[model samples]
Target: MNILVLCTGNSARSILLESILNRFGEGRVTAWSAGSKPAGQVHPQSLRLLQAKGFDTSAARSKSWDEFEGPQAPVMDAVITVCGSAASEPCPIWPGAPVRAHWGVEDPAAADEADWDVAFETAYAQLKRRADAFLALDFETLDADKLRDRMNLIGQD
Candidate 1:
């Protein structure tokens, strides 16, 4: 399965979720993340935390959602918005009409720099729980409606 995670900045929460999904999904899923309005660079703290957790940080970047609207882009199985603003804004017509879900997390990037570690860790834990729940489902047997319903319910926790 292919998944796309989105946020307003794409610098922290989205990046963190993308890395978590890719790392934890093993070979079963591929994940990407982008922003409605990108910050043009991945937040350093996000890179630091992900790297500390042994994730490959080379491809981590803040990019626009427009990049995924093209014909060459991967067709997503799901599109998850990880922030309130991104969840509320209009989204691009994702290829394949991926199931959409909002798993809102407080933006760690918006927190004070002194508290970045705590903020990032909190967001990471919340998102990891959701990602793990999604990964636990048997996607091959589940229909799209069932999958979408479960994904939405997972976000509620």
Candidate 2:
């Protein structure tokens, strides 16, 4: 399955969840992250935490959602929004009619620099639990409606 994670900035929660899904999906899924209004760069603390967790940060860039719209874009099976603003804003109409879910997390990037470590860690842990719940489902077998319902439930975890 192909999953797209969205956020207002694409620098923190969305980036983290994209990495988590790809790492934990174990070849079952491909994930990408984008923002409605990108910061144009990944957050430094996000990169630090991911690198500490042994993730390859070479291809991790904050990008616009426009990159995934229209022809030639990868057809997403799911589009997840990881912040309240991104979840509530209008999203691009993806080619594949991906199931949409809101997995809102407090933006660690909003925290003071000194508090970034704990803030990002808290967001990461919450998102990891939600991602794990989604990964635990037999999603490939379920129909889109069933998959969406389950995904929404996972978002609340």
Candidate 3:
């Protein structure tokens, strides 16, 4: 399965979730992340946390959602919004009719520099919890509607 995580900035929460999903999904799922309005670079604290957790940080970047709207783009099975703004805004039409869900999380990037680590840690924990729940689902047996419903419940985690 292919999943896309989105946020307004794409610097922290979305990036964190993307890394979490890719690492935890093993070979079963491929994950990508982008923003409605990118910050142009991944947040420094986000990079540090991901690296500290032994995740590959090289591919982490802040990018626009437009990159996934092209003909050759990977067709996402699901698209999850991790912030309120991206969830509320009218999103671009992704190539495939990806099931959409909102996993609203507080923006760690919006926190003060001195509090960055704590904020990032909190966001990481929440995202990891939700992603873990998602990975536990029986995708092979679940239909799209059932998967969507389960995804919504996972978002609430």
Candidate 4:
């Protein structure tokens, strides 16, 4: 399945979700990420966190959702929003009308300078937890109806 994870900036949360999904989705799912208003570059701390976790940060980038709306764009099976802004924003008309879900998470980039590392870490942990739950799903054992039902319930917290 091809999945698209979205957020407002595509720099932190969406990037994190894309990395985790790529690593843990086990070839059964191909993941991509984009933002409504991209930051134009991946956040430095997000890159560091992915690198520290042994994920390749090389391909990480902040890109606009417009990239996925063209005729050449890949058909998505699911489009999950990892931030509140993107989740609630009006979305582009995705091909195949991909299943949509909201896994809203705190935006580390929005944090004040009190303790930036802790804020990033908190966001990373939450994204990791959601990714693990998403990867653990037994899709092979369930029909499409059942699978969609289960995926919708993930990351409710």
Candidate 5:
């Protein structure tokens, strides 16, 4: 599945979830992340945590959600919003009418610098749990409606 994860800053939660899904989803999924208002760089702690966890950091970036728009863009199967601000704002209608879900996470970037390690780890754990649940489904066999339902249920996790 092609998944797009979104957040307000795209520096922490969305980036974490995108990395988690892509890493653990194996060949079953391709995931990218963007923000409604990007912070222009990946949060340092986010990169640090991903590195400590042995995930590739080469392709990680904080980008605008607009990058997903247009005829040449990849058609997404799902779009997940990972922070309350992003979830509450109006999102552009992505191509392919992708199934949407809100799996809100507290923004780790908001924490004090000293607490970033713990904050980022906590957010990562929640996102990983939800992504794992979603990837566990026999998604290829499920119809769009069923997939959407499962995604919503997984978001609640």
Candidate 6:
């Protein structure tokens, strides 16, 4: 299954979801993340948190949602919004009419902190909780009705 994880900035929540899904999706899923209005750089605290958790952050970067709208775009099985803006913004018609859902998370980049590590840790923990629920889903065994029900439960923790 190909999954597209989206956010407004593609810097924190979306990036973390992509990494966790890729790591735990067991090769049955490939994940990508993008933004409505990208920050143009991955958030530093996100990178640090992922690194501390032993995920490779070297390839992480902010990208636009339009990258997935072209005819040549990868057909997504699911397109999940992990932030407030992408959840509320008018989204482009996804290539495959993929299962769409919102998994809104607090933006760690927006948190005011003298030590940013705490903010990143909070973000990381939230992403991990949601992603764990998502990865636990048995997509291959579900029929359409069951799948819809399961996807509806995607980010609930």
Model 6 C-alpha lDDT versus the unseen true structure = 0.79
lDDT, residue 82, model 3:
84
lDDT of 3 at 51: 93
Q: On residues 1-157, what C-alpha lDDT tens digit does candidate 5 reach at each position?
A: 9999988888999899999998899899999999888999999999999999999999999999889988888888888888754335544334455588878777888889999999999999999899889888999899888888898888787
**lDDT at residue 68 of model 5 (Cα atoms):** 90
1 or 6, which is superior by lDDT? 1
TM-score versus the correct structure, for each prediction: 0.91, 0.92, 0.91, 0.86, 0.91, 0.86
Error of 6 at 37 (Å): 0.2
- For residues 84-144, could you state the per-residue lDDT of candidate 2 as single tens digits? 5433644433345559887888889988999999999999999999989999999999999
lDDT of 4 by residue, 34-124 (tens): 9888999998888988899899988889999899887899888788887754235443333454377777777888777666688888988
Global lDDT scores for all candidate models: 0.86, 0.88, 0.85, 0.80, 0.86, 0.79
Worst 10 residues of 5 by lDDT: 86-95
Deviating ranges (above 4 Å) for candidate 4: 85-96, 140-145
Best by TM-score: 2
Worst 10 residues of 4 by lDDT: 86-95
Segments in model 2 whose C-alpha atoms lie over 4 Å from true places: 85-96
In angstroms, how far off is 62's CA in candidate 1?
0.6
Number of the top lDDT candidate? 2
What stretches of model 5 exceed 4 Å from their correct place? 85-96
